[model samples]
Target: MIHLFLGGARSGKSSLAEALCHRWPGQVVYVATARSHPSMAERIELHRRRRPQSWHCVEEPLALARLLAEAGEDQLLLIDCLTLWLTNQMMAGACLDQATEGLIGALSACRAEVVLVSTEVGQGLIPDDPMSRAFVVAAGELHQGIARVADRVSFCQAGHPIPVKGERP
Candidate 1:
């Protein structure tokens, strides 16, 4: 089964995703997409502290589709933040459409149950900067594509989740 969690930053999206992971009967694998940076050390540490020690953590800055394709049947994966993953690929000069297609294809073939978290960035004002505008466009497209395939979808606001496309958790 595929589930998607969407929210603004610090809106308890990760916390809700982790809770769902804990409920899964299979082994939980957290596929972290953020790259470590000096400025993000504190935020990263917070996430580290939030996750249970029993869960296996994989820090993957790119090649998410490849990783998904390799998932074992006994695994349940929580891909924390697709926006960051998209950003990582975009900054690396990858073609956005091709990358997104590869990801959707890989996800369709994945054996494990999966849950994804992503920021809902397109709801806000348009950015003046070109790169930021591009990011929002990419994010919007990615979210829509995933939502089409997702078994469940929830939108978070003020730490509360309102079901969008399926049964509420």
Candidate 2:
């Protein structure tokens, strides 16, 4: 099964995703896409503190498709947030369309249950900067593509999840 959680920053989407992973019967792999940086240290630490040590964690800023393809059927893969992965791709000047396609293909082929968390960044005012605008567009497109393939989709608001597609867990 594939589940997707979407919301604005700090909307508790990650917390919800973690909760779902906790309920999985098999091993849970926490695939963290965010790169460590001084600005995000506190946020990263907060997430680290919340996750159980028993959950195997992999920090992959890129090559997510490769990782997904290697996952075993006995595992549940929880990708913390896709937006940061998108940012990493953008920063590396990677082709957005190709990367997105690879990820979707991996999702389709993956035997393991997967849960993805992503921030909804396109609802606000247009960005004044070109890169920021591009990021927003890319994120929005990625979210839509995932939503189309996701078996379950939920939108988070003020720490509450609202089911958007399929049955809630």
Candidate 3:
């Protein structure tokens, strides 16, 4: 099963994803994509502290498809956020289309249940700069694409989750 969870910053999307992982009877892999910059070091530490010690952590800023391909059928993979991954790719000057296609293809072929958490960036006002605007547009499109392929989609608001498409607990 593929689940897509979307919310704004500090909306408890990650917490929700972690909670959902408990339902799966298999090893849980936390695939984090955030890079540890000076400004985000504290944020990184806080996230690490909150996650379960038993869950395996994989920090892959890109090439998620390759990681997904290596996952065991009995494992459950939770990708913390796609926004950082996209940012990493953009900063690295990687081919966005190819990378996204690869990720989608891998998700479709993977046997293990996958859960993706991402920020909803489309609700805000359009950016003034061209690059920022482009990033927002791309991120919005990517979120929509993933949601389309996801078996379930949920929106998180102020620490509460409302199922957009699929069953809720």
Query: How many residue pairs clash in each candidate at the backbone level?
Result: 0, 0, 0
Tens-digit lDDT string for candidate 1 (69-112): 99999999999889989999999999998888888888888999
Residue 102, model 2: Cα distance from true site in angstroms: 0.8
Q: lDDT: which is higher, 1 or 3?
A: 1
- The pairs that clash in candidate 3 are none
What is the Cα-based lDDT of residue 99 in candidate 2?
Answer: 94
Q: Tens digit of lDDT per residue, candidate 2, span 1-169?
A: 9999999999999999999888887899999999999998999999999999889999999999999899999999999889999999999999998899899989989999999999999999999999999899889889888888899999999998999999876
Residue by residue across 1-169, what tens digits does model 3's lDDT show?
8998999999989889889997777799999999879988987888789888898999999878999898888999999889999888889998777778778888888988999999988898999998789789878878878877889999999998899988763
Please say which candidate is ahead in lDDT: 2 or 3: 2
Ranking by lDDT: 2, 1, 3
Cα-based RMSD of candidate 2: 0.8
Output the better candidate (2/3) by TM-score. 2
For TM-score, the strongest prediction is: 2
Q: After superposition, how far is residue 90 of candidate 1 from its true place, in Å?
A: 1.1
Q: Which ten residues in a row have the lowest lDDT in candidate 1?
A: 17-26
